[model samples]
Target: MIFRIVFLCLILLIIELYTFQVLKTLIKSKPALFSIQFISLLFLVYIVYSLMQFDRSVGQTQQMMFTMGLLLIVYVPKLILTLTLMGEDIYRLCVGSVNFFVDYDKSADFLNSRRKFVSQIGLGLAAVPFLSLIYGVTVGKYNYKVIKQRIFFPDLPDAFDGFTITQISDVHSGSFDNPEKINYAIDLVNEQNSDLILFTGDIVNTDAKEMHPWIETFNKIKKHEYGKYSVLGNHDYGEYVTWPTEAAKEDNFQAIKNLYGEIGFNLLLNEHTFIQKGEDKIALVGVENWGHNFKQAGDLSKASGQLKKEDFKILMSHDPSHWEHVVQHDDKHYHLTLSGHTHGMQFGIEIPGYFKWSLAQYVYKQWAGLYENLGRYVYVNRGFGFHAYPGRVGIMPEITVIELKKGVNVA
Candidate 1:
């Protein structure tokens, strides 16, 4: 980890040097350039000092926030400037090579002039991402948007028609710096007044103790008519942090599971339960943490043991990769699956119904929103809270409400 950090810092430092060199043209005064560089150097030094002094045991929210701010304010803009500068350099190289070949007597002044123009253009182009990242840190992170989706299934029970299910996932409580804001998000969840509520894992970042402060706040989340159900995500297994002993890790996992119940959530681990309305019933199957490259504790066979293939099953698996690798083509057809591991990378451009994209798409095919394959559907909620990075960019925190409709559509 230390080596990785050092390597990353070295790369960022190089990029910063190059970016500031180009920026020198904009601020032609040597004193002003020196002042800006000095301030940036101070910020970088502070970041390193804070990281070294940060407390890992309690989840260092302040330190992480600072680092996130640095990334947004400094590194991200540098990245844009670097890329733009690289493109111009490539173009200049091609043009210069042609000019040298055509006329051996040409002076270097033209290339130097183009270089200045390229630097200015690069800096100008860099502002869009810089401003967008600033917005992400200040407002986008807490911008809670509720996405309501209506899913029609021929197998959906008649009694469950129009049944509303609110799903939230990846509540990385350890990263939260504002409790009041979280309380408001919970209030929004209750305001939906859905019949059932499902949480698709990642309740805490790395430790169960991190959630102690928010227990009561979460308990205040109004119960749905059918009840609230939760499943363990990869982080819930307490695998990210080191424990003194195996038993200690087990204890932490148990405490988290217990906390789920304390806050009115039916913590499901490789289990199946039925939610009934009148005489009609649908199976809600929940498995432990499961992903292609992540934890594989989820046992589909065990969770679906009591149900038949014909049952209308809703599976809650934390990582959407489970759907692509396991659930989609399984013998026991799962009508729907809910997941939230990707967090949409907490960044990306999303134009609803027109163009939706994130770097996360390259990593996970079903990173966010609804996807269907072989009549089995999965909706990957962006997330309910921030995690490693303290803030979100284009992808805001999510509150998903899925309304189940019964019927078939012919198109």
Candidate 2:
């Protein structure tokens, strides 16, 4: 607790100090100095107010002050640096280009290039954090809801027709220090009326015990006829937290598995389950913690083991990297894979006419949402919880309701 507070204070202190330095530099401009100083003092007041945080009431306010405090600590300095450094470079480039074309100013001076310099600073200041806030509120707001959509197997038997699946990934339950918001998220999922709930890893931060208070809430979550299924995320297996020993960490993993069972989840570890939608069945395969580095423990072979050559398959692997590393190239060629680990870099944009997800560049060709290659499909969930960073920036908290509509099968 002390560390968290101090850590927050230090970064914010840096921001305060940096802002002061910026103001001090603007000493020649009385208005700039006064304005900067005034804003810094108001932020100081907020810092003082945040010191009153109590664990008892932690559930009540959503830790608004603490979250804001940390975000500002994070937001301000970066805003300053981004607005400063980025503004300077853009100013030089733009003015230099104009100078080349018009041959108006032979000078390459920073201050003398007044018009271009000021405009760059103005736009840069307004843009970065606004973009960040859009991400934060959309992703961080607990009330933000996502639904599972259903698509059928062209071969998806009539039994599973109209099967609406509620998918959640990267519910970094550890991010929340309270129950109300967590319960609210659970309630939103229940409201979806999904036939099956597939949580594609990242069940908790580092401890299964962290979820003790909300075990009741989780148990109360609504599910479709088929029930809920889950897999372990990188965070779920308890690596992020420090343990007394290796054995202790292993014990925590066992405890986590127990918690999954306790919550009524058929937690699949490198295994597959058959969703019998009549004579046509779809294989739901889940692998354990198959992510970037740490032992790619998930064997696609095991998850696809039970399938016949003609069977349709769906895979749930935590890291989207698995899509590139295993699933797409696998012999069975999974028809659809569900993953959530990317969380869309926990920030980005996707709209009707345009789709841009930064994580796609490195992780998979399709980082978030649905992507199709021939008849094969992959839908990546953007995660419902926050991690490392306290708030969401752009990638909103998601409850993806996937409606799997089957089309003509590709040979």
Candidate 3:
């Protein structure tokens, strides 16, 4: 732990020095420059202090969220500036080396003077994330977007063709601060009016109490014709923080599960049910939180008991890794899986139908949106709420509306 802290501090110091170089190059006013530097130092100190104050028993709190937000807002831009300046330094080194070998007079200078435009350009690039982080914390966290997806399945039940389902994931209720904004998001979910609604877990950050206040707000989500169901996410297990006792942890876990019922969802724990229409049926299977790096409570075999491989099934598994690693290969032939654990890292660029990218892709193959393998599909909702970082950037919180089409997609 001590070594990790020292390493982190060293990295911060280097980032500080490089960022300072940019400021010094751009701003000639010493007073103004010193003021900015002093403010930056204060933020650094505050971030470290706030992090130190984190209580394991208490877990996440609003202050901790603010501290995390401030840390990113302050340093992400600085890191960008640092990298940009480092690139210039590398260029300067190569030029200086070439000059030393060729011309003795030029070698006296050793290195070329830093270009003002380079510094300016670096600052310009840095401002994008700096402002973006600020906006994310202030406005983007609640910037909900309703995304519509149309997926085609050749073997889909005729009665279920064109069936619509709305999906929301990773609520992280503990991090929410704006009641009005949340209510608005709930209204948006209702506005979709899909035949079915599904919630892919992480209802609260760690404690069930975190969702208590919003229970009524979420209950506003009207009942669906096909029914509402949910499965647990890693955070719902309450394993991230220290608990007072085994009983306390277990009690918290149970309460977290009950939160789904309070919000009008059938909490499916390693079980399967059938949604029927005109004597035709499709299976709905749900499992506990199963993650490659976190929990492994989900049981595919248990969830799909008595169901045949050819049965058309829609699965609700919180983590996409469940589908990527296990479900997709299982002989049960899960036709469609819904998930939302990635939250697209709560930051990324998405241009629907054209491109989508996030840091989450490096970790989870199906980080966001739709993915398919051998006719099986998984739609990973970006998320309905923010988490550790306390905000969303380019990847706004999402409410997914998926339409099931009976025919194969041609385009």
Name the top lDDT candidate: 3
lDDT of 3 by residue, 289-396 (tens): 888888999998999999998899999999999998999999879999999989899888888789988899899999988999999999999999988898898899
lDDT of 2 by residue, 1-411 (tens): 778777866766665554454445435688878886787667666655655454332221336535554555445544565456445557668878787667776665433333434434544674676666644654454545574444546776566666778888887665676577777888888888877888887777777766676678788876568878988888777765557789978998898888777777889998898887656667888888776655477877876776875677778888877776667877686877888887676555556337665644575566777777656778888788766556655567788887766555344
Q: How many backbone collisions does model 2 have?
A: 25
Model 3 pairs in collision = none
Query: What is residue 185's positional error in candidate 2, in angstroms?
Result: 2.3
lDDT-superior candidate, 1 or 2: 1
Where model 2 places Cα greater than 4 Å from the true spot, the runs are: 1-120, 127-139, 147-152, 359-364, 409-411
Ranking by lDDT: 3, 1, 2
Flag the better candidate by lDDT, 1 or 3. Answer: 3
N/CA/C clash count, model 3: 0
lDDT (CA) per prediction: 0.87, 0.69, 0.91
Per-prediction TM-score to the true structure, in the order listed: 0.95, 0.76, 0.97
lDDT of 3: 0.91
lDDT of candidate model 2 versus the reference: 0.69
Candidate 1 clashing pairs, residues 3+ apart or interchain: none
In the range 124-229, model 1's lDDT, one tens digit per residue, is: 8788778887887778879999999998899888999999999999998888878878999999999999999999999988888889999999999897889899
